[model samples]
Target: MSLLALTAFAAAATASVPVHSVALDHRGGTYKVDYRAAVETRARTIGMSAGTRPSTQRCIMTATVSVDRIIADGGHELHARVPGEKTFTRNLPGDCRGRAEQLTALVEDRQPAIGAHLAAAAASDRQHALAAIDAAHNLASN
Candidate 1:
């Protein structure tokens, strides 16, 4: 490959954002949570609901959680991909940074309770909720 092409490829590879970690609490009956994943600048593949199509040019994250038997027979896993573009030419805008900070805070506030529940629940029941919560929390914090 040409030197210029190699440099461009390296830059693009390095440009991809990385996911961060955050904490969570799940004492409340609410299992649904939201958080930001690593940022990305290029089109990417993301898993979606059975009937939905994967997205492109977006931020993607995964989630695994156990629902109440009443709500879902077993456990479920999910991947959430938000559609958007990221520009690194300058410092992130105040609004965007604020939103990111808020998400981090939410994860920090919620992880523990969820983790505790996962540790205490039956293996089968625990798998669904714990996996989902862990995936969601990991993505959000990332």
Candidate 2:
């Protein structure tokens, strides 16, 4: 049936990609880019085979402050928050102030949405893997 085929395709697509891995090619900040790269690396290590990360452990995500010359021509106020911390304030230098602020704003805006997606996907994968292990253990014991 067409419905069955569609369902199969959907599952395959979902399996092929990590659920919350970000694809932000356009909004690359020097700091945000490096931060995102690390998250992407960790995302790849997850899934059915790679196994779940330990529950208690946590890691910092990095974001740097840098300006793009084109955007920096018109200076703007900047504010940004890194992951799991209160918003940090900065007094940027005059030359790249506009660019730096723009980058920070983009990073702060994108970080939460992306972080949420990654967290949810990672958790779902973790629970699914745990359930599979439990089922396998019971089957083996029987």
Write out the backbone clash pairs for model 2: 31-64
Which 10 consecutive residues of model 2 have the lowest summed lDDT? 37-46
59: Cα error in model 1, Å? 25
Q: Over the full model, what C-alpha lDDT does candidate 1 score relative to the true structure? A: 0.34
Candidate topping lDDT: 1
* Tens digits of per-residue lDDT for model 1, 1-142: 2455334433443332223222333544344332223322222223333436543322221122221221221254354433332232222212221133333333334445434433333233434545666666588788
Worst 10 residues of 1 by lDDT: 89-98
Q: Tell me the lDDT of model 1 at 86.
A: 26
Model 1 segments beyond 4 Å from truth? 1-16, 27-76, 82-85, 90-142
Model 2: how far residue 108 lies from native, Å: 0.4
